[model samples]
Target chain A: MSIRSLADDGATLVASGLTSLQRAHPDLVAISEEPAYVIRAGATPAKVALVSGGGSGHEPLHTGFVGMGMLDAAVPGAVFASPTAFDISTAIRAAHRDRGALLIVKNYTGDVLNFSIAAELAAEDGIATETVLVDDDVATDLQRVDGAGPSQPDSHRPGRRGTAAVIAVEKICGAAAEAGAGLAEVAALGRDVVHSSGTMALAFRACTHPGDDRPAFDLGDDEIEFGVGIHGERGVEVRPRAQAGELIAALTAPVQEGLGLGRGDAVIAIVNGLGAMTGLELSLAHHELDGYLGARGVTIARTLVGNYVTSLDMRGLSITLVRATDRFVELWDAPVRTPALTW
Target chain B: MSIRSLADDGATLVASGLTSLQRAHPDLVAISEEPAYVIRAGATPAKVALVSGGGSGHEPLHTGFVGMGMLDAAVPGAVFASPTAFDISTAIRAAHRDRGALLIVKNYTGDVLNFSIAAELAAEDGIATETVLVDDDVATDLQRVDGAGPSQPDSHRPGRRGTAAVIAVEKICGAAAEAGAGLAEVAALGRDVVHSSGTMALAFRACTHPGDDRPAFDLGDDEIEFGVGIHGERGVEVRPRAQAGELIAALTAPVQEGLGLGRGDAVIAIVNGLGAMTGLELSLAHHELDGYLGARGVTIARTLVGNYVTSLDMRGLSITLVRATDRFVELWDAPVRTPALTW
Candidate 1:
């Protein structure tokens, strides 16, 4: 039997979901449907506005994180598609204050292109904008050729596919902006977070699109799509299904190595559910990851465990580690009040 | 292919999960291994403590709700099982403060029996206690005789199975207790919330237990288990798959009628994901529910949309309506600091 979800259809999914999200958090977020974006509802103090968006289906990634102490606005496209540059530009114009705005874009071709164009569009209207590109997925980092020229075809080395680490980028950078950091300062902070983070994921089952009859991919009984991304796509390789410890290790060791984390290095860890993974499973992974890191003499300064970034309803999870400085830890602990994240 | 989850063997799932949970939210909660209960880590104000728990699958329910402005202690049983009376009494003793303790027990035979015995045990130790039984599920409301006698076997009429409404009860009552309500007053408030609440759930697919090859049940592609419970059991009836509005109406009308909700009646609405349901689906359901209620002239005073209570990874969602009084709304808006819920 095919997996099913309680969605009307793919075409209207994003609009309808935004309506509900705005209704559920009217005090926190407001929806603008003409250009299609969600902005903070209530008044915010004058600070650099934080705006981010990509595709829909990753609920709470951009929209759900729009509230006080987070994004000032979020532009959402249809399910798994990039928001139009016009939509992003309109949201930036509407959300930016005198301090201007910062655009946090995930490392995907369409997202980078659209967000960059929107930044220029906003700048034409006298709105100062800075972009922080998030490309923390270690899975896609393998194809990076040393000293590859900029002329190389984009497909050959797309850089790392951004994954769950965007949560860290958006959260920490949003905190900095909320603290009245200038646009350049906030962008610098976001880039620092992106630089310090790495993410890896695996899926036991693929996600089924809304109204579709079958999942995006299939897996054997004892196989896993290791190093999966956030678009219901298969992973870099197939691996035999093993114990939870081994699976978590496979995802975590690379992230730690990529960040050059060592004994006594503190980090902010995220055990993010792609979509269909349960809190029970995610918790087990975090516990195992904690034990693994502790054995490696690493200290987990803070942790977030939830479906922050999802790939529709894929049954898997990702591990993100951001090497945390005292400032990052302080900002991560800062108060935030969004629909998906709050403190 | 059989449904699979990223879990260890079934026997150690809860323990392993808790270790990770405590690791993730060390500042918010602490876990006791011997009795397997989670309690607020730091000192809480002297007041009537709120203690709750049930089987482990429905995470973020009792355990995840344990922290400030919510559950004081949560005694988790193994997956789909009940904690022993000894476990309940120990948690009660540890959680109770100078004011006493209040046991928030979901309406399951195992849960009721153990909590009742634990209350008595606590009384013997000079610890005053009260119990507020929650039976908000309308599915099992069938077969409940108007004036069933005490001698009637529970099997014949188990009444309603408590589901997602317990979140409102725990949250509202926990706030009251935190604000220094006595045990009797807190218990009375909890009972009022329970009496004012009703929940209905449906599943597109049944949940599979960890280490199990098959699911709890199966459904045809065009069928849904209407009025399903949180334990992954079949619903009260099988219904043809319909559009989102019709499915939502089917779930909401009964709940509205059961609560005697009419024009001008206000409510706190919840679109709770059973397990695998995505936030996209939940948001659409909430939007539909909101539209349905608005057309009927009822105002939704507050809204909560997420997987607050889940039945493992069941592909389903539940709707809960708690008739909102001003005091209930006030308490609902109170500050809370838990891992799963914070504001």
Candidate 2:
């Protein structure tokens, strides 16, 4: 249930928001009237079109990223709901050039199914397409057991859920594609990015649904959920809240271990807010994470700290670390002019 | 009380966070060792330097904006407290070249006094300096009488509290300075920006100080504070909470009236979050404001919708509308590469 929304108008809210964004950057972006994909108006068809989308709530993710140096088109559904195959197909058709289109899909059941079907539909229309799945959440790295000493193999769990690391993938892949990389090369770069990255999130409070009055889940005054998914899915564990340093330590340990980062390993760190966290709090958390990683001998080569990817009004944050090579660093620093991620 | 922060150490947290930011953009920014102003690393002495700063809690406002195309130096004090005259003086000395330094000071009492003294100190040191005062908050537009309507004129109150519109002033003035405008010209541009802009903010919830457990203020679940100041000050009035559209209408009316803008006037609309508000909610507010302005026959030339300026963890938003001319629009669109407020 929404504690701070104009109830019962989530879809209209999203569409109108996209309209204003397009109006703001008319030179770089446009919104198609039907099935409504925010397309890059000035995107040159020199390389493969990079298309990504999902639900509406995690804004500035796919839609805010559609511009010259980022996504070619972004397809949005109703809040937290997947875009239909028809909508995705329409976006692909509009964005497809002579090169091809690459679909960047998060590892969600609905998104995977719908985007795959859209890819098939595009292929039938003679527009070549490929999909790169991003499954970088280390919070769901292992499955939970009923009552034993908390030991379950990774294979026992469903695949890790995708989170903020998708932004890193899109950015690097966007740069690669903008430099005229072919569809296969862009796809491979995205895959490599996914393979080299890990993210973990924790929720301080649950987000209320747009039209609902009750929160998606309840939390005690002194409790926090660790390894929380972007949606209201229960985290791997809930515990009495710890200090910011302790929380960062717990969060970064899993990510560092998963990425196998050690002393002298250069990496890009993103401390992303999951909506409703203060910039001050996020910076404080970033401070703690920096010290923790530095103490462990990891070289923090680059950093992005903000509310880039969000879960509506959920009061939490996520951390993503991408191991950086010279090529990746160069690509990361390349100029991007998007509504959300820009430099 | 802080519901989400680790207790205490606000100053250390800020310092460490700034260190991480400096590490991220080594080529663009650095923090001075003694007084700790975030300074642009590669600033050339060819043009007048633009400098701004205030308190610490407002991340990215003064510091995050220190980079190539925005601020030459940003001096941060403790959270929600003003920087000392010495610190501002140090920043002025460091940033001043033969072209002089322009100080962009928000119109808080402490900030005004300290920055003014700093200007005097800089003059004593033979560095030509000018100050541009921004007082664009329309929420504090008129003085309050005892149980009466807002009949008192602007002079009767403690002047309008500066808020988010300062970003507009800084950006435009920074551009003007970068284009080799003299100190007087840059100062005039900033004053014009302030005179041509108005902002009003509302809060759904109050933020707690980092070292405190109690919130700065409190509101009932069904109420909101309108015309709130950025320093957790109580608003001009309290009202029953309304839907998103109604809230936007309430916030935008004062701003539109204060700016005296109507009918086909081009404007840059900034729907800024006061921390802890979701992008979904802010975008919704922007959508509503866009419709409201369009219905009034106003043309939105540019739009910036995000948590650019914040009030710690206060869950609310502010709307700033800058009446745009060709020059203002060009300056707004000028490339900026700051840690925050970049394009």
Candidate 3:
């Protein structure tokens, strides 16, 4: 249900969704409707305007945070697709009350390309712009495709793969913007948020987008797929489904090893829902995580387990680990007034 | 876990859970720590202190609402059982700070009996007390005996169910307190909230309390128990699992009929989670609801679908419909912050 696939009828539905959203949240939508869409609490322009958008389905990520502390304006795509270059440009234009705009994009090909084009358009309009791509998903970074689907020999690379890390970017960048940081500093911080926060997911089933007649990926009823994307894309591991705790352990093994988290090291762990898992399950997963980390001698000071970002109704859970330095924790604790991430 | 089922080892884990909850939310735990406690904001004595409680597993319900604008205090039982008479009586003592206390109990047999005893104790202490039973669940009121290790034919009755409608009482009651409404008026309003609210549930599985390792009732993997209660008690219809939309309609049917929702009717529908559904799934359910009501020619003015009340990790959902009048909507819009039900 990307913008590309959004036909006249679907656009009307999207319009209806937007209308419903605006009607339900007039004040929130009002903030987004501002001339320079970011409402920074005063007439004074923000030194750095953090503008971000990609898929439409990832809610409260950009739009919900468009207030005093977080993002300026969020351009939404239909579902999992990237927003048009025009919409991104329009959002940039609307948010850049200051001299520059900072764009945060996921590392997906369409999102990166679209944001780059938007930045170019913003530059033409004399608004300085910078872009940061979050690539923190272990599965994608280690992707080695051999001849047989995901079993390709070269399908294993070791690097950052992005998942729920964009949430961290929205939070940190939002706080940085509110703190009146400059464009360069905010852009750098946004990149760092992406650079630091990493996540990996395991799906019991694939997602079916709106009007999708079938699932995007096939998963046996007894088996689980590890490292699937938010779009229900296949992952690195398609092994037999293990016990819930063992499943979490397998997902965390690569993440913990990659982060080099030692004994007594404190980190911020997020147990995110791909879509279908309940908060209770997420909390249970967190309970298991506490034991898992304890068995590994790791210390976790702050944790959040909920459906922050989703992959349309996919039945899966992701383990996101953000190395919580003092500053990162401060950013995390900063007040946010989003529709979803309220505190 | 129930207090009875807790062996020394399991009791330790349960205690640890409470400890974690207390540490994470001190103000929230203040209501629970006292076993039964009262918290008043204003210096002036109120007419009736509002008190509510049930089991420990349902977070934010009885405990989360304790604050200036909500419940004076809430008593906690172990898991899904009723609070002890002593605990309820103690809470009354703590809450009877010159004003009387009103005990709001859901229509659970144990809760009714326990709170009634507590009320008698409070009256003996010269603290006047009133009790109101919330029987909002449209589902069967009693447990079904499979083979019945013990036959209790009189207990399990049909047409008794409850859900998040209790949240409305905390809300309206809080407003009543703010408006300095008298005890009679508040009591009447509390009853009105129940009268206006109708709830029905669909369980994916059964609920098991402490001491009962087995579910009160069991369903096959492909089964969906309609008209289920919070306690994982048996439901009315044990139908095979269907699509989420169909399941929601099944639950909403009783609610719509009870509320007498008509075409062009404006209503506030809360697609509440029984225990385990994620917020995202609830939102998706809301989306379905909007479509359902739209097709039915009903106009939904406000929708608050979330895990307002839960039944441990029971995988189920309940739909609570409060036939919306403009006044209730305003009351809902009224801002009052508390531990869980913050505006």
TM-score of each: 0.96, 0.95, 0.75
Whichever of 2 and 3 has more lDDT, that candidate is 2
**In model 1, where do residues sit more than 4 Å from their true spots?**
A143-155, B143-155
True contacts reproduced, candidate 2: 0.55
DockQ of each: 0.68, 0.54, 0.13
User: What is candidate 1's lDDT per residue for B153-259, written digit by digit as tens?
Assistant: 67776678898999999999989988988889999999999999999999998888888888788888888888788887667777888888889999898899999
Residue A102 error, candidate 2, Å: 1.0
TM-score of 3: 0.75
Two-chain DockQ for model 2: 0.54
- C-alpha displacement of A320 in model 1, angstroms? 0.5
- Evaluated on chain B only, candidate 2 has a TM-score of 0.95
Model 2 C-alpha lDDT per residue in residues A108-227, reported as the tens digit of each score = 989999999999999999999989999999877644322322355656645878889999888999999989999999999999999999999888788777777766888876778878
Which candidate would rank higher by lDDT, 1 or 3? Answer: 1
What fraction of the genuine interface contacts, i.e. the true contacts, does candidate 3 reproduce? Answer: 0.03
The alpha-carbon lDDT assigned to residue A24 of candidate 2 equals 68
Relative to the real complex, the DockQ score for model 3 comes to 0.13
Where does the lowest 10-residue lDDT sum fall in candidate 3 chain B?
B1-10
Over B87-133, each residue of candidate 2 has an lDDT whose tens digit, in order, gives: 99998888877799999999998999999999999989999888888
Count backbone overlaps in model 3. 19
Model 1 chain B poorest 10 in a row by lDDT = B142-151
Per-candidate fnat, comma-separated? 0.69, 0.55, 0.03
Clashing pairs in 1: none
